[model samples]
Target: MDLLIDSFVSAILLVVSLDAEMIAIVGVSIKVSLTSTLFASIIGIPLGFAIAFGDAPGKRWMITILNTLLALPTVVIGLFVYTFISRRGVFGPFDLLYTQRAIIIGQLILIIPVVTAFTISAISRIDERYRKTAMTLGADRIQTAWVVFREARFGIGAAVIAAFGRVISEVGISMMLGGNIRGFTRTMTTAMALEYDKGSFTLAIALGLVLLSFSFGMNMLFHFFQGRSRL
Candidate 1:
């Protein structure tokens, strides 16, 4: 019990002091996560809009596939990407394995479904009148989309935020694809895992605290956007 208390105390101090190593780990995490989330948003948002508004055959099956993907494990994604990026694979010539870029690529795949599903939900909930009214006003396709986008902005924001949160907290992809290279690809989650294996708890605890803070912030932002969307 006393050891646990001491560990927490030391972890708090390390976080309060903004330990340089911790900052670097966190920086890598934020960089890769934000980059992945940005790419996912770009691809997923439009794809979602298309799926939600366009009449396509087997749409139910498509949504089912996407929803299933939402539960796809990070490690499975890691192994899948590794096969393509590792030596002797199709794209292995680029030598992207064990790099920050590799982590971003994996995280991108991980969150695209999240953004797409959330976007579809958001776009679906808007009253049908918005689209009809836009068309009635002589708005062209692009303009109509803009109108719908404006109305669904908050919900979309929450989706992107949720995607960011997903990548920031993930570990399996970072470990398998990034190799957890210190000062480079080591993210908060990977670093915590390493610290745990090394029997060191302070840094791990500090990183956990930082991760929890990010999660809390994301949830608050998500709810804030959701609330605004209701109005």
Candidate 2:
């Protein structure tokens, strides 16, 4: 108990001191997570909207596959990306393995499914009457999709937040794809894992505090959107 208390106190001091290494890791984490989330959102949102509104053959199967991919294991994603980027693989000439880009790619894969699945669910919940009304008013397919998306904006925002939350906290992809190289691809979750293995709890605790704050902020934003939707 005393050790734990001491670790917590040290963590507070470290954060207060703005420890350079800690700050760097946190910055890298934020940059990678935000970049990957942005990319995932750009790709996933449109795909979600398409799947939600389009009547193409095998659409149901595609959605089911996407839903299943939403639960894909992080380690599996790491391994898959690792194989593609490794020396023996086709893209190996570029040497993307064990870099920030590698980590971002792994994280993007991890979160895309999250963003897509949530987006689909959000669009699915919009009232069918709204769609029928829009079509009746001469709104073409594109306009109808826009109307549904506008109505479902808050829910879509929630999906984005959820994707960010998942990728920011994940360790497997970061560790495997990034090699957790200090001063390079190291991130909060990976740093915490390394520190824990080294029995250095101070940095881990500090990063955990930051992660907790991020999660709280996301939840608060989600609630704000939820409240607005209700209003």
Candidate 3:
């Protein structure tokens, strides 16, 4: 009991002091997560908008596939990407395994479905009049989309934020694809896992605190935007 308390206090102190190692790991985690989220949003948002707004056939099936993918386990994605990037794989000649880019790729695949699903939900809720009104105006196809995007911005923002949270805290892909190389590909989650395995709780506790704080912050931001959108 006392040991746990002490460890947590020490961890908090490390965070307060801005420990260099902790900062580096956090930075790497942020970089990888944000990069993946950015790419996922770029691809997923437009794809989702198309599915929701377009008159394309098989839209229901596409949405089902995307929603199903949202539940895919992180390690499954890790393994899937590993197969392609491993030495024996076709793309292995580029040697992308165990690198930051590898981590981003894994995370990117992991979050694409999440972003897409959320986007679909967001845009689907829009009153049909918004689109009709836009078309009634002088808006072209692209301009109508921009108008819809403005209406759905809050929901889309939440989706992107959720993706950021998912990728930032994930361990399986980071460990499998990144190799958790210290000062390189190591992230807060992977570092905590390594520290725990090494029987060192300081860094682990610190990272846990950091992760909790980060998740809380993201959730707060999500709610804030959601509230504003309602207004």
Candidate 4:
């Protein structure tokens, strides 16, 4: 127990001293996660809105598929992307494997379903009366969609925040696609895993602290939106 206590103290001191390596890893993690989340939001939000509001025959099946994908394992996505980026694959000429971009791609795949699923739920929760009222005012389909979207903005914000939270903490895609290259593609989660494997707690604890703080901040933002929607 003494050793554990010493490690915790040392970790705190390292964090306070602003360890460069730790900071870099955290920065990479944030960059990759945020980039991927942004792309996911761009694609997922519109796709989800279309699925929920469009008149396609397979809308129910699509939503069901997306909901199932929400629980997809990170490693599965990593493997799936790895195959496509590998030398034998069609897109392998780009040499994207083991790069930060590769990790971003993997993370994007991991979060798209999450964003879409949450978006559907959020949009669905908006009162149907809003859509009815817009239609009664002689609004076109596009205009009604716009009105409904505006009313559900808070909920959509929550969906995005939730997607960010998921991507930030994921390690499988980061490690597998990024190769966990130190000072390059390494991220907080991957760094934590590497540090723990090396029996070092300083970097791991520091990254853990950062991840926890980020998750808490996202939760607070989500809660803020929920509160605003209630008003």
Pick the TM-score winner: 1
* Residues 1-231, model 4: lDDT tens digits: 887788778878878888998889888988888899999999999988887777789889998899889888999999999899999977799999999999989988888998888778878888999999999999999999999889878888888998899989999999899999998999999889988999988778878887898999999998998776655
Residue 132 Cα positional deviation in candidate 2, in Å, after optimal superposition? 2.4
Model 2 CA lDDT for position 25: 97
Model 1: CA > 4 A from native: none
Question: In model 2, what are the clashing residue pairs, if there are any?
Answer: none
- RMSD (Å) of each candidate, 1 decimal: 0.9, 1.3, 1.0, 1.3
TM-score of each: 0.98, 0.95, 0.97, 0.95
- What tens-digit string does per-residue lDDT give for candidate 3 at 1-231? 988998989999999999999999999999999899999999999999999889899999999999889999999999999999999987799899999999999999999999999998889988889989999998999999899989999989988889998999999999999999999999999999999999889999999999999999999988976776666
Q: Please give the ranking of all candidate structures by lDDT, highest first, separated by commas.
A: 1, 3, 2, 4
Tens digit of per-residue lDDT, candidate 2, span 58-77 = 98898899989988899999
Q: Please, what are the lDDT tens digits per residue for candidate 1 over residues 1-231?
A: 987899899999999999999999999999999999999999999999889887899888889999999999999999999999999778899989999999999998999999999999899888889999999999998898889989999999999999999999999999999999999999999999999999999999999999999999999999999998888
TM-score, cand. 3: 0.97
Model 1 earns a TM-score of 0.98
Backbone clashes, each candidate:
0, 0, 0, 0
- Comparison by lDDT, 1 against 4, better one: 1
- Name every residue pair that clashes in candidate 4: none
Point to the candidate with the largest lDDT: 1
lDDT of 4 at 147: 93
